[model samples]
Target chain A: MERDDIIEYSLHAHHSAEEGVKIRKKIYFVTALLSIITIVEVVVGVFISRSANEFANPGLWTSIKIGYIALTLIKAGYIVLVFMHLGEERKHFKWMILAPYIMFLLYLIFIALYEAVAVGHGMTL
Target chain B: MSGEASKTIESKVLWGGKVSPFSISYGKMMMWIFLVSDALTFGGLLVALGFARHAAVTAGEFWPSSEQVFTHFPFTHAHLPLLYVAFMTFILIISSVTMVLAVEAGHRMDKKKVAFWLALTVVGGLIFLGSQVWEWSTFIAGPDGDITTWADNATLKQNFFLPTGEMVDGAAKLGQEGPHAYAMFFFFITGFHGFHVFTGVLFNFIILMNVLGGTYEKRGHYEMVEKVGLYWHFIDLVWVFVFTFYYLV
Candidate 1:
């Protein structure tokens, strides 16, 4: 594995050692980004569970909840754009693949939080 | 997946065809299509979980704090919150990175690197699946007996805690009243995601075998590895949302 001695038969495939190093660097960067976000999420999440009156401050609690979802979407985006190579696709095609998901996330976040708040306020529906 | 140069298309024949308009390989395109569809299905499941959560809220309970519920961390019971699930998230992310490396190796036709990364990926997937089993078991056998047993009780008691550190009947504190809707959603949503991880591990193992047997070597392409890599990444993607709705929020 140390040496790139394996046969590469595909057209336009196979990168030079430098190119491989660059790609690995990008992967490492994305890995770090994802890990840092998860750490922040867990730390804050645990802090909220421990701190006084988390639900007492509705505005702050709501922002923190939204922040969790935001960080989550960022993680999902990295996995899609970097790990799944959607970023390498054509521009229009990339959005063609992404529009539905973007819409889905919006719909989910809005409805779930809206319903939760409404119900917590004693709304029936 | 040839040259990245974007050539202009003639306006007159624009609608005629470029079945592969993106110039992506047929296999890769199909894999993307499958993943998009699969993503929607998983999204729908999460939405369903969201709706079910609201339904529980209507009944006066959404859920106990996830950290409190998911506190068990294998060996000791020192009461670490979100630690186990957070570690699981880390594992999935690492496995996803390995999957990317495996795909990169396949492109370079480096059989050894591909095998190494893919083997590590399979191990990661297995660990994740095993952890899911353990989590489900812990969830099932809750603070009291099995969570299912508590569902039948009009008022159930468990070691559920509020942020204030006050101990209360977990169900009463969670839902305030009603059948255990949280348990149902927990079973279905995570079970569905767990099933995906199961298939992902299976697919990764199968591809690892193909890589080992040099099937793609003779075929002159490692596109199969890319396809499975897409799937593996999708699993991690789905888990992000699952972790959000099911555990984090």
Candidate 2:
């Protein structure tokens, strides 16, 4: 079937070669961004572990650990926003999909960490 | 009177005619719901991991450090920590990019470009699956020649030599209970993620077959490709969390 014959709702119409090229550039851009982030993560993982020594002073190590989590979250956000096309979604729809889950996850993590620490104390006592 | 009666009858019907409040197609909306639920499932597992690790720490048990554990790279015997997993992450991320491209091509009604990018996406997924398999085996086999006592015995040992030759109390040994708990959690979490990746590969393969068969061509729209792209991207997104919880953090 030809594009003209299709009777369906679509976000964009048929495009020329220039439009295709533009999309290709965007794809490469996303790829490059993800690649650089992954590289920075690996670099940090290797060097920070060597320099800080997670066992010696866990406090310093933890700050570095927080940095890793931040980077990972950033990467995750980018993938969800761009690759999943959630960024293109209507704002209300995006919030409807994302907000509850984010809040719930935060709650779960908090409860788990707190309870785990309490349990550890019990075991030690 | 006739017009008023007809309007009353229309309002009385069961279906709401056009109730897509989100302004998205039914399939896309359904995919979003599934993705949200799937994300929660992963969140639960990761939270459990955090609990386990924290408890081990509190009880003075040995919890294995991910950096020390995932140091093996492919081919060369030298320990290149996180390199292989980084490669796997890049493969998955690039595959996600290809999936977006396929969706864009679908928007343009460019069948050839859609098929081409979709094929590359599938290949990327396959490579990632293969890498995960290798990683699982290497993990199960234990890191490079029994570097720790836990390798020989599942029991957590208090003392193990770090890659830097510094001796430290392994998290498994803190409570004097051994590393079995740590190992079990590691296997279960990564195995679960791997299963998701496997299913994702299968999903992509089916979609690719349909694309090759020109099913979308006949339908006049490649919305099916877009739907599967949502799923593919979800799989990648889950891996981002898993990678952080399992390896990086």
Per-candidate DockQ values are 0.33, 0.45
- The models' CA-based lDDT, in order, is 0.75, 0.75
Off by over 4 Å in 1: A1-12, A50-52, A104-125, B1-19, B55-62, B143-159, B163-179
| Pairs with backbone N, CA or C atoms under 3 Å apart (clashes), candidate 1 | B60-B175, B61-B175
lDDT of 2 by residue, B1-249 (tens): 543233432221212342334456667778999999988888898899899889977888766667666666766678676788888888988899889998889877788889899999989988998888777666555444353544453212321335654435633223343356766777787788778878877887898898889988876778888888998998888888787777787
Native contacts matched by each model? 0.44, 0.68
lDDT of 1 by residue, B71-132 (tens): 76887756777899999998999999999999899887899999999999999999998998
Which structure among the candidates has the greatest DockQ? 2
Off by over 4 Å in 2: A1-19, A50-52, B1-16, B142-160, B164-166, B170-178
Q: Is the docking of candidate 2 incorrect, acceptable, medium or high quality?
A: acceptable
Candidate 2 chain B lDDT trough over 10 residues, lowest sum:
B6-15
